[model samples]
Target: MNEIETAPSGEWQDVAARDQLDPDFPLGVEVNGQPIGLYLLGDQVHAIEDVCPHAEALLSQGFVENGVVECPLHGAQFDIATGKCLVEIGERDVRCFPVRVVDGRVSIKIVPV
Candidate 1:
């Protein structure tokens, strides 16, 4: 499980430790009641909406490969780094949050940066 901390709106909130992220697996977290998925690509961390727009599945539970994540339920695919829908079944693109790492901790800003 990933650690979670709440913060005021537009502020960066600590979500997990940098060591908790895996290149092949995404971490699911909820910030201010919004489900978000955390992905690690190389040394960079990305944060995006977790829910599949075409269905009610968590994107974090999907299969990840080569910067893309495929919805486990309906086969919808999205770019993990850009949150862009890559498949027709995805319906639309998802929201992306800004991520920052400091002192071995992973933090994200839900508001547009």
Candidate 2:
């Protein structure tokens, strides 16, 4: 697999390859000790924080509809592409990361501070 970028902390790790992912299901990747949600919508891959801000639920376990991922526990909605919380129940925004496919290999650029 090809690496798009290293973590800000300079740690070496491999999340997953492009072919290993299921486009229809949410994939979980841990980079720099952070859990990231990886999903494929259409022909592009998106990465966001896996944890729901309103609760301890995993966003990856939530439902994805019309580009919005709804929290399974409290029914909070968030735009997966932008990580913006869509409902008033959860005002906190989820973190987003840059995802890129290089040479048929998928790699996500870890969000840095």
Candidate 3:
């Protein structure tokens, strides 16, 4: 289990340790019970909804290259840093979460629907 810390605004929740993340891969984690995809590009970590907006594929399960996550179902690519659908196969854009690194922990800001 990981320790969770809430932010002053009660939105950002600590989800995982920075050391636990793989720089070469994307990690799937739950923040406030919502599935999220965590990607480590260079020294920065980006957070987006785990489910691809275009299909039923998990972004964490797809191939990640150059800060872009490619959907395995249709080859549509999304920019993890902005959650923008780079190659639009449909009118779908992934939701992005605000990410922060505090004291070696990865914190994600999750807004309830």
Q: Best by TM-score, which number?
A: 1
Instruction: List candidate 1 stretches off by more than 4 Å.
Output: 1-3
TM match of model 1 to true structure: 0.94
Q: Report how far residue 9 has shifted in candidate 2, in Å.
A: 3.4
What TM-score, to 2 decimals, does candidate 2 have?
A: 0.82
Model 1 per-residue lDDT at 64:
94
Report the lDDT of model 1 for residue 52: 94
Q: Can you give the TM-score per candidate against the true fold?
A: 0.94, 0.82, 0.84
- Of the candidates shown, which would achieve the greatest lDDT relative to the real structure? 1
Ranking under lDDT, best-scoring first? Answer: 1, 3, 2
* lDDT for each residue of candidate 2 in 21-112, tens digit (9 for 90 to 100): 66557877667667778877778788898888887688888888878888889998988899999997766989887777877776666645
Comparison by TM-score, 1 against 3, better one: 1
Residue 1, candidate 1: Cα error in Å is: 6.1
Comparing 2 with 3 on TM-score, the higher-scoring candidate is: 3
What's the residue-level lDDT of 7 in candidate 3?
A: 48
The Cα local distance difference test for each model comes to 0.90, 0.75, 0.79
